[model samples]
Target: MLTIGVLQMTSGVDPEANLAVIEDAAKRCAKRGALMLFTPEMSLLLDRDRARARAWIESDAPDRVIESLSVIAAKQHLDIVVGSIPVAAGGGKWANRTHYFHPDLGPPVTYDKTHMFDVDLASGESWRESNAYEPGREVVTVEDTPLGRLGLTICYDLRFPALFGALGDRRCDAIAVPAAFTRPTGAAHWHVMLRARAIEAQAFVIAAAQVGRHEDGRETYGHSLVVDPWGEVLLDMGGDAPGLGFCDIDLGRIREVRAQVPALANRREIAKS
Candidate 1:
């Protein structure tokens, strides 16, 4: 069994201020004896301006954000899972990438978000993430302290079930869905979708979310949660300040649940049946 921390926050356009809050939360979680930590998506900046967002992307090998996080994780001797960072991947395209850094690892490994949230809301809040960002081509899974084989995913990908199936097939013991979900959609389907992923995959689902309003006046539903293989919520924090939660993860439980259900091996292809 291993202890994990989930940090939920209300991030905005200021990177410095957000970093300060994240540092404090990480310190607190480390103090509480957490071996692994996960932060919410957009944990660095939350501006709608495409120009400013583009400027924040780092071109250097050791991006300032990753460098700083590496130092912190090494100092604390903790495995840190950074939510989402704006990354440039050639052709003037930016990818919303999530990173996983272990204490001994030289550099953090990353997974870009595959799904872009492009929705036309009835309330006039339209988003075209694809216009500013490129979708990722691969699904990534990595091993870290406390969690054996962990799958990484960002906010919008939670809506797609095939992603979870892919992770399960890769033998992911836990899945992290770091998000900055908008108020409307989160209120409508967040809980159900998160729980379903945990139930179907039989893997621990750790979701750290962004809450409150942003500089763009866009409200995010912040309810960071952890669900067990049985689809039972272990921890739930509803729109509170940045904080962490702890849960003991049993690596053996993943194998046990999969063996009991045996659904993964039973998957079949339908051919116009």
Candidate 2:
């Protein structure tokens, strides 16, 4: 069993403030023997003003948070999976990208968010993600990691099972879902969906989430979770404040679950009646 860390945070408009939170969490989790750490989406900054956010990104301007994380990863000898950072995409748009840094591997692997969240919720919560960011076309799965084979997905991507199916097909042992979910949707679908993904894909699901209200008047549901292959909720950090939580990722348990069910090996296309 490998120890993994999850950072539950409520990020705001300031990158520096967010970095402070991340740095603190990183040191604490690393000290606690977490081999790898998964942080929440928008770990850098969450600004309602897209214009201001875009202005923060530039070719010369550094992503200080990621830079600091890389250094922290090396110093602590830990693999770090940063949630998502907004970077320059040019053409008057930015990209929501996740960065994974290894203790030895100097450069990080990046994955742009594939599905954009452009929905108008019934609870008066609305997002126009397409207006500010460009969606990614390729699916991503990383095989080389301390926590076995891992898959990456952001907030809205959690609702789409085909992506998780793709990851499972690639034999991913676990999936990381970093989200800043709205309170309503998080309340309704968060727990159910996380468990479903684990059960359907037969992969461990670790979700690091944003909690409470933010500077932009956005309130995220806090309940960062870790679910095993048997659809068990291993850990759910259910607090209104920022903190660190950890879970064990047992590859043998994944093997045991798959051996018992043999679900993936029994794949077949259903015929339409």
Candidate 3:
């Protein structure tokens, strides 16, 4: 069994303040004997104001936030999945990117969020993420982690199954789905969808989520979760506040589930009409 820590955060516009929270969590995670820690989407900054956010987003080069996280990972001797951060992707656009930092690895493995959240909701909240963010093109997975082969996905990508199917095809032992879901949509579909994804992929799903109201004037549904291959929810951090939660993942369960169901092995593609 591998123990991992998930940080449910109420991040703000200030990257420094957000980093402090993460640093504290890393210390606690290390003390608790967790080998890896996972954080929520927009872990550094959650500003909706493009003008104000532009100053913090960096292109190509390692930004201050990334550098800080790298140091934290090395210092704590803990692998960290910084759920997602905003980085300049050229053409006046940014990428919602995930950075996986390992203590021994010099540079982090990165994955940009594939699907963009472009919607006009009935709650009168409209988000056109494509306007300011570029979409990622490739499916990304990290090999030989504490959870075995781990796949990466961000907030909006959870709504799409093809991505998860590709991850399942790759035979990922675990998938990280860090998110910052809106209150309305999160309340309606969060638990069910996450549970379904875990069962479908036959892989452990670790989702560290944003929670409560933020300094940027938006609210998010928390409920950071860890689900097993059998669709059992191992941990649910609840929707009330932000904190660090830990879950013990039994890697052997992956083999057991696959042997019983053989979903990934039995999967056959249906021809398009």
Candidate 4:
């Protein structure tokens, strides 16, 4: 069984403050014998003001948030996944990227968020992420860990099915979904969407999330989750509080479930009319 820790947080615009909390949590996870720690989206900062965000976010040097965790991972000999960081993507834009770090690895594995949360809600919450960030054109997945192959994806990507399907096809044992979900949408769709993904892919789904209100006055619905291949929620960390959640997984379950169902192999392309 692979032991994993999911860290739920409510971050602000200050990178230092966020790092303080995350670094401590990483140590705890390491001490508890967790093989890896997964964090939520925008693990560094979540600033609402575009000007302030651009002024504070950087691309010229390594992000302090990721750097600190990288050092911790090496020091403690742990593995970590920072859900997403808003790094300067040139031309006054940013890329919401995920970083997977290992104690022995030189550089953290990266996955820029592919789907942007561009929507207008009926409850007066409107976001235009494209205004400040550029979308990633490629999909990324890694397959060399104790937990078997795993696919990495950020918040908005959860709503899209095709991405998860493609990962399922690749025989991933688990999928990482880290998010900073808005309160309204999360309350309505969070649990269902997460369970659906696990059921559809027949893979373990691990999601760490941001919760509560931030310095920007925006609120997020937080319920960090871990689902088994049978789509049963093994863990659900409650809303808005910072803490660590654990799940002990057997990777062999993925193969057993797939063997009985065999959905991926049964899939066929549709014929054009």
In terms of lDDT, the best-performing candidate is 3
Quantify all predictions' global Cα lDDT against the true fold. Answer: 0.84, 0.86, 0.94, 0.87
Cα lDDT of candidate 1 equals 0.84
Tens digit per residue, CA lDDT, model 2, 74-134: 8878888888988887787788999898887488888889999999999987899999898
Residue 110 lDDT (model 2): 83
lDDT of 4 by residue, 180-200 (tens): 999889999999999999988
**Candidate 1 worst ten-residue window by lDDT:** 53-62
> 1 or 3, which is superior by lDDT?
3
lDDT of 3 by residue, 74-191 (tens): 9999999999999988888899999999988478999999999999989999999999999999999999998999999998899999999999999999999999999999999999
* Candidate 2 residue spans exceeding 4 A from truth: 270-273
Could you tell me the TM-score of candidate 1? 0.94
The digit string of per-residue lDDT tens for model 1 on 203-253 reads 999999998877878888888989887788888888745566667777777
Candidate 4: residue pairs that collide: none
TM-score for candidate 3:
0.98
Error of 1 at 123 (Å): 2.5
Please count the clashing residue pairs in each candidate, in the order shown. Answer: 0, 0, 0, 0
TM-score of every model versus the real structure: 0.94, 0.95, 0.98, 0.96
Worst 10 residues of 4 by lDDT: 58-67
